[model samples]
Target: MFNLSYTKSFMIKQKFTIEVKIIFLILTTVTVVISLLILFFTTKEKELLITLGISPKEIELFINRVSQELILFLGITILVLLIILSILVKKILSPIFKLSLATRTVASGNLDYPIELKTQDEIGEIAKDFTVIERSLKATIRDLRERNKEIELLSKITTKMTTRLNSQEIIGLIIEDLTTELGYDYILVSKLSEDGEYSQDHIFSGDTQMKQAIEDILEEKIENIKAPVSKLPFLPDVSSGKIVIKERLADFIGEVIGESQSDAIQLMLGAKNFVDVPLHIKEKPTYLLLIATSKETITKHDKDILHTFMRAASIGLENALLYEEKTRWADELEKKVEERTKELEEMTAKIAHQEKMVALGTMASRMSHELKNPLAIIRSNVYFLKKKVPMELMKYLDMIGRAEERSNIVVEETMGFVKGVSLKKELANINDCIEEALRSLSHELKKVEVEKEFSEDIPSVLIDVHWIHNLFTNIFINAVQAMEEEGVFHPEGELIGKITIKSCVVNSNIEVSISDTGKGVPQDIKDRIFDPFFGTKIRGTGLGLSISREIIEKHKGSINVFNNESGGATFTVVIPIPE
Candidate 1:
């Protein structure tokens, strides 16, 4: 393969040689023929003059003149021939000069340089060869440029796609590069379903109006378009790691979408050629990238570029999928750790609660046994003295008896709280229970006014009467004590205290409300009021409300305390009615 410069140089050298040869041959032949003609004409004239009896001096003069004129004519004729040969040489070499110029222009990277030479000679043949070489060089240059462009696009795709670890985002970037950088008319990415039985359209990037038109014709959103792999017969070929290119795309699209809609969609999109390339993950095809254009043809080099792009994209997709999986696993592991930590915390708390209850039970056990004996002896002595004492001392004895009984009740409450209470459920009236509680606190209720609003239609509740009585007793005692404390603090003569108790059937349950005109529970500690050993009182076991809550919960009921509208606090208890 001779380079253009070498070929041009050689052809120019050949042109020079051909022109020299023709000039030499023509000039030498002309010289020879002219010399012979002069000799012959001189000889014939000499003989004729001699035969006519001419003088030697006259003959010599004639011959001399004739020779001079002939020599001059031959000189003029040779000069003319030389002039014509120069012109002919220039004309013969004209096409070669043009071809040389054309070659130089092309060598300077101007493929568009015009080559116009027509002849019926070797020069013409050489010109034709030059034209062919020019075209071949043009195509080669164009191909090299195209390959460079493809390399550049691939470089961009690799840079952009590798940085993205999100599958959808990588897919989007692929579409953008294909359409915007690669100059494809449209790009669509369809992902294979997990079952490997369906390929669903995940992205479509193209003209907005064209996309809308396709969507409308299919009567489905672009993303929602899907087809079984079996229906699209070309997909298997794609899945098997082969690039599938289809012309007359309507028939192929008709297989997936419908025959009728395909024609309309093809028209709207103006897509004549379509190429589908497989996108692989873990060495298996998991997606298809479809590129379409309205152009009548796609070059083999273009398809090769598409294949290279798809390969890079497949690697990107695999990386993204792996990243997502890793993230999901990380999240799941974090959640599991959190759940296990919560369980351990709950178990630790439960064990601590059990230890605390054990300690409480031990204290209550010793206190109950120690206090009960002393209380029994004091009450017996008080009874014995009541009979022996005079009327004045009888009051003293009664006070002693009351003090001993209060001590006994305290011991019983402590014991009951430590050793959880057992219920003996029976059908009984809640009103009757309330009246009994108030009666038990009669000796202490003299300073406070008590009002009762009992409903006659109250249903009989199945409850442990003893526990219910104890629950009410604890609430009443707290209320009276709160009021007594309030009176002590009052700047006025004394705080006017009132305790109102109401019972009614509400929401298929026995709702009892006990309202007192005493200090209300503080807002900050409202939620914690039911907790064990929590209270506002300076001197108390703090088990009253806690025990009450436990008993009510045992009965499958609820008890809540809130500030009343009038003043002080209202403790509301609701016990569900038996069906």
Candidate 2:
């Protein structure tokens, strides 16, 4: 069969034309040698046959035999050549094929993929060079990835630092970033005292006692060093407190810190390398950016990032200090303004009170003259009615007399509020005064329930008995008026009101508070309740409470009014006890 299958497989796989070229070369050389030998031997044999007088038929027959023999030998040679070429091509391409597969794998990012080509040829040399390049590229990629992570972390940090203005927050964020993102074991953000000493403000890691020992050591050590003031040509290197990173800290633990404390830190956190980047704040030279790592030594890139953070931190610190100062200033200004406001209010109140008293005095003095004439006419008419009227009409005369008398009393009290009235002083029982007021208003209190919470231990108040009587009467009358009425009958009637009178000796005063449960004092009218002639009642002049207040004030006492929680108004009168 005329077939060549193995060679076809090699062409599809390796793509090398070496086997085809070699086979072609072998076939061309064999054809050339055979043609040359046939030319020489056949020419000589033909000449010898002609010289031997051979027959034309025998020569033709001899040429045909040689042709058949040549065809058979060429066919055998071509078959042998194809077999040899297939074996050689397979042998050579095995290593090259493996290298090709490995190259594809390497291109796909499998750097550790082995190039198992053992051939010592040009192909092997190319594979060896490719392996070297892969190793170098792998290392480069790892470094790039590490750098990218740090840069991304830095980007986050930059965003954070520029965002908030709080110094403590920035410091805390910096410490957190260092520990969590950058892998630090210990960090401290300390402020230096005015006298050039370090104070540990925030400690991030390690055992408490050991860290404290280190802090104390740092403080003592910092105290001895020249403070890093800008006055110097170069800012002296301090620990994380200043720009100086002393060499001794890197070599061994406590030469710069303290032997025992360094040992403690080394044992506590596997911290070896340390970094001190100083932040210059406007307030003082006591600022520091102290950081340390446990596993790897702090790298140059880390230091660069730390330096940038320190600069931002310095700005943040100054801003916070300024903000604090501004806050203090604002607070002081507010306090002064409040005090001044209170003073102005008091002055305004005093002026208003004096003006009201003056106005009341003026009006009373004027009204007295005008009212006396009418009063005298009233008195004369009543006297005449009593004489002329029959006995049956005498009751009407008595009512007229009582009305005229009440009018006179109201006028007198209204005038008395401003012009000091002569007081009839007596050792009067306060409870008796309250009882009298209740008794006077008993007709109104018939529907209202009265409750008393009097303190038996209360000291007697120093007051004019007549004035105290008026005061209690005014309070009780107001209470009875404020009580809400429901109905006229018994069971269905819920007394729409209640009055609670409580008395107690508070400090140096006898305090009485009268609270009523009724529709609460209208918020709008509460301030005007004590104003003369400001009456809610459809009755005579509204002078009762004004006169009551004046009388209490005359006794060196004060009266306050407010809404009761349950409902209605509570009038509290505070009267000082008799010396």
Candidate 3:
């Protein structure tokens, strides 16, 4: 059958001529019609001439005249028919030719051009079909481009995760990326206990209203759990693999732990409309990735990709946990060994020295306060003297100014060691503090092209305004210094420097994060950033962050540092919302 098919195709290619066949058909029909007309005319003429008894010469002349006229008429009619046929063929084939060219263009991966032929014919129908094909092709290309972008972003995130080696940061990146790219309103990451209890560790990209709602649910559950047996009997068990009522859980876990249930329910509700994947470690449930979206349904392909990511993330998480645990154990063992050695070598001397140091610290605190007022007065006097001093005396005034500033810094550092000293706290807008700090450094910020993204609805917190200002100023100064050291400052070109101030509520506390686009602190030095006298600068007075930490702590707050994923450092401060 195959050989016959091949032979038939070969024969047709060699023997067939479509043009010849069409020409032959036209010629044959024309010849037949002409012959019939000639016969009919001849018969009619013979009958008429015979009836009239016409002479032979006259008949011959009439026949000759009629033959010439018939030849002329046939030639004119054939020429007109051929012209009409040529026009008809051109009209019929023009659209098809355009469509063929369009198809070839599309095949070469150009969908920008469409077949633009409008006719009320079969060709018009083909054009419509081509439009549909073109739309579909464009959509496919767009989807591919979007997917490629997502993959590239994910790759960068993964690389950052590996280098940072911080689990919290990794989860943060995941939540942020998922919410931004996937259009999710809320993302919750939870870990399940061996007995089925769920502990949600992170919630990202949720509005304040949603955060409050989730918090209320958790609080109600927690309060119920804390009630006496007479009020509530059983604790809500989320880990039981069954959805339990939030109110019921209040009975099991104390209000503190029960309130966590509301967060779980919020997650469950989101999971129902979105995607939920369990992160597992060694066949045990370790974490859950909950994505809540406004979308009606998740496509199967999206689910497949999410599931694959979940699997990979689960492995990565388990490995990270193991590494962390091992490191923790090693650290504890080393600490114990150090403690034992210290105790054996200088137990008596250490105790005596500690007591002396405490006494000295107490005296230093008193002396610092006493010296601060005097230093301030001298600093003010030096400023006044700078305006009145002669050119020769100007250098002396500058020296005095430096000495005064140095003394004030020393006093502040001494005061940092003094505990339980509280500043006068007032309700303050965090944005005000941020702006004031930036204003003080406006010249530097303008040079760097500062980018501000402050949350408008951040609630006010009771804080020492001066302390907050100082804290922000110190961080800003450090960032500027880091950028200068790294040569990241671009004057004529686009500025490489960027400072971001963002505030949000986390766990009922106001959290402020200040990020700078500068070379970050090295890992070895990061943890010591808040320690006194840990400066990396040439001037080397590392008391700025130490004093900042002290001020924040005095207001019952906490501050920590982390490297931003995009080549920078971020300092995060969390303080309670004043009652």
Candidate 4:
């Protein structure tokens, strides 16, 4: 049975070249038959001529001549047929030769070169298939390279996350990796509260324009409210507040939870695309991982990778939060355990500082609420004057209106800090906010050449309006102060001082960055600049950044101060928006 099977296999293998063998056999048979026919006809014709009355010698000559003619004709025909067959064979085999060479090249690991075949036959189709194979191989190589890069980046992020003990530092590292390494436009990592609400916790990559815009909007909304001084919007109400889901809620939940829940919230929030995964601890959903891209669809691979990242992030974040909570508990326990003299003094000082802050926050909130109505009135009157008054005075009127708007923002931010009020979350245009903030500071920004780069396609965000406005004003004022200190106000100078404000939506948050070409923040005070009541200038309140932080924290946002590599101080604020 094995012998028979082997024989059948051999026959099947031999069956492939049957057509070539048949053609060769047919050509050989035709050549043999033609040769015989030529010889017989020539001999018969010569004899017939001799029998028909030609002389024997003449017949012999005729026979020889006919034989020679027959031989020459047959030789020429054979040569012509052989030449034609050779040309045909070469034409048929050229593509096969090229394909063989290309295959050899591919086997040697050179995938860039493509084989070119012009024939419209089966060989050409085979060449086409080879080309496709080559392309696929190249594509696969490219994909592998990208994957390697991603893995390298993941490794780096892992190292950084493990080494950095500070939560803010870790978040910054993540954002930096996503922005610089992954080339993400924005990155927002939010902590999901137990109530299924997102708190704006960490933002890494963002531009100045977006941040300024957010700040401006937040300031304006708070200023616009007609509220009593005692009932100011402030911090306790704002911090850890729930982000309202308006549009794209289902998509967000699907991304953070699972696709199985997409239908449940479709009626509440219309969504086209989103990705969400759960961050679990002990099989319980401790956090929800959400990501939103400008892309209309999320690929399965992307979802898988993002899920992996979220798992890693959840572990890190959970560890940090737990550590913080434990530290707090430990400190409390120490206070109770050690009622010694030194401990009492330290506790007294800490209590005094806390009390002072509370009192200050309350007083500032009251003053802010009181100032808002007057600022609004001034703004209204300025607008009225601008419309009713002549164009010559319109510029002046607009400036007055802007100044009033700025004052209103400052006031609202103060009230927000005092009252602990959360911003009324809404979809806000980042570009519009930046434009308005710049416009409000036109008089001041115009003194120093202002440069702006605003991305046209930034997505709107859901955030508190008052806090963002405060954030922008603080940064803008700092820029103005830096320029003033550097004496860049001279009308004639070789070096023109400039400030650049840029905004963009990256990852899932809005970013605003402000950079100035002035004497940078001094290194000695750079670390303490954001602390309350820490100011380098004698006339300055030192509370600008401190208040800014308060407001930002209230909105679950962040503000960072850094010296630009080129020159000057750069302030960047990132705000997370609800999907």
TM-scores, one per candidate: 0.69, 0.62, 0.37, 0.37
Q: Per-residue lDDT for 1-579 in model 1, tens only?
A: 237677667766876786677878997899899989898989999999999999999999999999999999989998998899779877876777787778767776788887888887888888888888888888888888877877887988887888799988888888888888888887656666765433445545555555555445344533334574345443324545667877756456655554434434655446777777778788777776667777788878778888888888888888899999999999999999999999999999879977997898798889898999989999999888888889998878877887886677678678878887788999999899999988877877867789999999898888989889989988998998888776643365655688999999988889999999887887899998887767788888788888899899999999999997766899999999978
Clashing residue pairs in candidate 2 (N, C-alpha, C atoms within 3 angstroms) = 237-244
User: What root-mean-square deviation over C-alphas does model 3 reach?
Assistant: 28.1
Q: Could you give me the TM-score of model 2 versus the true structure?
A: 0.62
Q: Can you give the lDDT of residue 28 in candidate 2?
A: 85
Winner on TM-score (1 vs 4): 1
Task: Name the runs in model 2 displaced over 4 angstroms.
Answer: 1-63, 76-92, 144-177, 191-210, 219-253, 256-270, 277-287, 301-373, 383-392, 405-473, 479-543, 560-572, 577-579
Candidate 4 lDDT at 405 equals: 67
Model 3 C-alpha lDDT per residue in residues 1-579, reported as the tens digit of each score: 025445545444533354345567777888898898889887888779878999978888898898789889888878886787668657865686677667656665678887889998899998999989888978988888888876775566556545545566666766775677556666566657665455544444334444454445554533444444334323223343322223223223334344445554444344334445566667676666545555655676667556555555555666677778889999999999999988877888667756865886778778887898888889889888888879999988877776775466557656755653468888898889889988866755665757677777778878788778878878887888787777853566645787788888777788888888788989999887886657888874577898888888987899999888888899998888765
Clashes of 1: 0
Q: In model 2, what is the error at residue 242, expressed in angstroms?
A: 9.3
- Over 1-579, each residue of candidate 2 has an lDDT whose tens digit, in order, gives 112354445434554565456667877887897788678767877888788899978977887787688768867876787688678767776666676667656665677997766678888888888788889878988888887887787777777776776767777777777777667666655556566554456454434544654554445543332333233212224533444443334334333333444455454334555566556766456565555555555556767767666666666667776787888899999999999999999999879978886887788878876887898799899998899999999988877776775567666776676566667777766777888777766766778788999889875554577678778877776776666422224476656567899988889788899998766678898888787767777875688887888888878889989987766889999888876
* TM-score of model 3 (CA atoms): 0.37
Per-model C-alpha RMSD? 9.1, 9.0, 28.1, 33.0
Superposed Cα RMSD, model 1:
9.1
Q: Summarize candidate 4's per-residue lDDT along 230-289 as a digit string, tens digits.
A: 242211121222221123433443343333222222321233433344555444555432
Each candidate's number of clashing pairs is: 0, 1, 10, 34
- Cα lDDT for residue 141, model 3? 84
Q: Tell me the TM-score of model 4.
A: 0.37
Off by over 4 Å in 3: 1-78, 108-121, 148-164, 200-212, 221-276, 296-302, 326-579
